[model samples]
Target: MDVILFRFGNFPVTVLEAGLALGLFVVVAISVLLIVVLRQSRSRADAEIRASEHTHELEERISELLRTQSEMTGRMQTMAEVFGSRQSDMMRAVNERLDGMGQKLGQTMTDTTKHTNDGLRQLHERLAVIDRAQRTITDLSGQVVELQTILANKQTRGAFGQGRMEAIIQDALPATAFSFQQTLSTGVRPDCVVHLPNGAPPLVIDAKFPLEGYNLIRNAERPEEAKQAQAQFRRDVGKHVQDIRERYLIPGETQDTAFLFVPSESVFAEIHENFEDIIQKAHRARVVFVSPSLLLLSIQVVQSLLKDARMREQAHLIQAEVGKLMDDVNRLDERVRKLQTHFGQTSKDIDQILISTDKITKRGRNIEELDLGSLEELPSSERGNNQPTLLNPALKSVPAGE
Candidate 1:
């Protein structure tokens, strides 16, 4: 068993070499471990500085993105304002055009209404005038009907008959060529007298209208009354014929046949049909029953005769005037012959005077050879004053000129 111990210079000394060497080795390992820990701590501090620099770079990029977004929002706001202003101007122009069109439409509608109203007013006025004219025509028609009624009665029928007869006579002959109610020397007055030409006596025409009994017969109700009235009418016709024969048929005083005028055609036909014997009696009595148609024929015949007589008289007067005109023309021809004879004689006398003047003018051309200085004689008045001339020659035979 060996044991080791060390001893230092202090109090006790022992020798232990192995244990001392182990202690020295442990001190050296502890120093190397402390140096390695210091180097690891320095490397941790360098890594922390690099991480802080990276964090600062990220913050700068975020701030630049925010600035770009703000500039874009400002430009969009300016574009919106310009578009709103242009839209307002377009809306104002459209409103002004619509107002002008509305005014023109209103004026046109008002003018059309006024023209239609005026046309209707004129039509109403024309209708009123037509209505007034129709009323006037209706009133005139009523008056004409009343007047016709008054002219068809019995008591006033005589005046109407006279007027109708006068119209018929006037129509047959001109009233200016005829005289009515002319009285003759026999105290008989005729109804009409027609004057003729060439100093012929006027023709006498009597108007006798017998219509009383005829009217009674026309108005009879029963057949027996009609027969009785017809019989009375026959007697009345006969009496009227007799009366006309006595009043107007004066031989040599008036015409041979007297005119008995029946104004109505129906009355004349009745008298001829039922009273033929009365007409024969009238013919025997020199009374001619003349209807309006027959009277017109007779008047026309008389007028024709008068016209022929007038034409004949005019022809005679024209012949006499033609004979007188022929005499005047013969006298005018004789005066023209005498004037031509006087013109021939005057021409012969003028020719003889011209020949005598020519002979005198030729003899005067030789006056210078006849001693013209001594040929100057005294004046004729001095010679007459010197000698008294004999006032008268001896009155031989005593002719009238002498």
Candidate 2:
């Protein structure tokens, strides 16, 4: 290294001095480097301060976000609890309503089943009754058919001849005034005998019912057979009338001049129309031939005579009974007058008793009123001491002065 030296006024200079000066210059350069290092450190510190301010601002924003999140979580929990409680209540109410409906439906079904069973039972009973009635009707029809068959036979029809004719005559006549099949002194038995009111001899009625020929005439198929049967029936009727005259027409033994011949109704009609001469012959013999209808009219004539006599006797009885009744009515009138007198006396006694009862009742009412007035005259303090108290103490006080 080479060194150069220069001198200024009032200074000394050397080569070594100049070298020292150069060393000093180097030291100054080192000092300047130190100052630069310090300034850089200060700038670094300023940058660190700015970073810390930014970190503080970010921390405040994070804290605000955390608070908002906590509030939202709490609100969601409260809503969930409220919703659960409301759902539970709704489920319980629905269960109760369903149970009530089930019970009602079951009861209704039972009632309907019982009603249906009762209806079926009633229908069965009605059907049984109808069946019984049908059986009864069939039995009655069979009995009626059997009765008709019996009436159609010959011997059975004859069995009803004289006795049945007498029954029919007796039914037409008065019962107490008529007799049947009476035997007279001439050894003749008439079908019917009637007694008069004055004890006269009985009238004679002979039964001359011709049934066999009439049944044959009705049963004939051809018109010739029917005509032959009718002629035979007519001859039979004539014979029966002539026989009745021969057997029963004794003048004083039967009646004075009349006798009755009771023929079957159809035979009598036929004889009157076709063989009127036969009836005329019977009339000439002093024996009147009579059908059931003529016999009924003759009985009515006799009944009228007997009824008139009975009415006369009953009139006397009624007059005596009426006189007795009048006497009883007079006695009843006297008893009614005495009862009226007793009723008047009883009414007057009742009135006097009622007046005495009223006087006693008035005296009792006056005594009760006097007792109530004495209670009113008591002093309020004395009344309160003597009176009964109610359960509530507030009711013990009465209104002032009354």
Predicted structure with the largest TM-score when compared to the true one = 1
Which regions of candidate 1 are displaced past 4 Å? 1-158, 171-177, 185-188, 195-203, 342-402
Provide the global lDDT of candidate 2 against the true structure.
Answer: 0.66
For residues 238-275, write the lDDT of model 2, one tens digit per residue: 67667776776666555554554544576667767876
User: How many times do residue backbones clash in model 1?
Assistant: 7
Model 1, position 112: C-alpha lDDT score: 86
For residue 379, model 1's alpha carbon misses the true position, in angstroms, by: 43
At residue 161, give the lDDT of candidate 1.
53
| Candidate 1 local lDDT, 122-163, one digit each (tens) | 888988898898898889889767544533454455455555
**Alpha-carbon lDDT, every model:** 0.65, 0.66
Off-target runs (Cα >4 Å) in candidate 2 are 1-159, 169-176, 256-294, 311-402
lDDT of 1 at 57: 41
Clashing pairs in 2: none
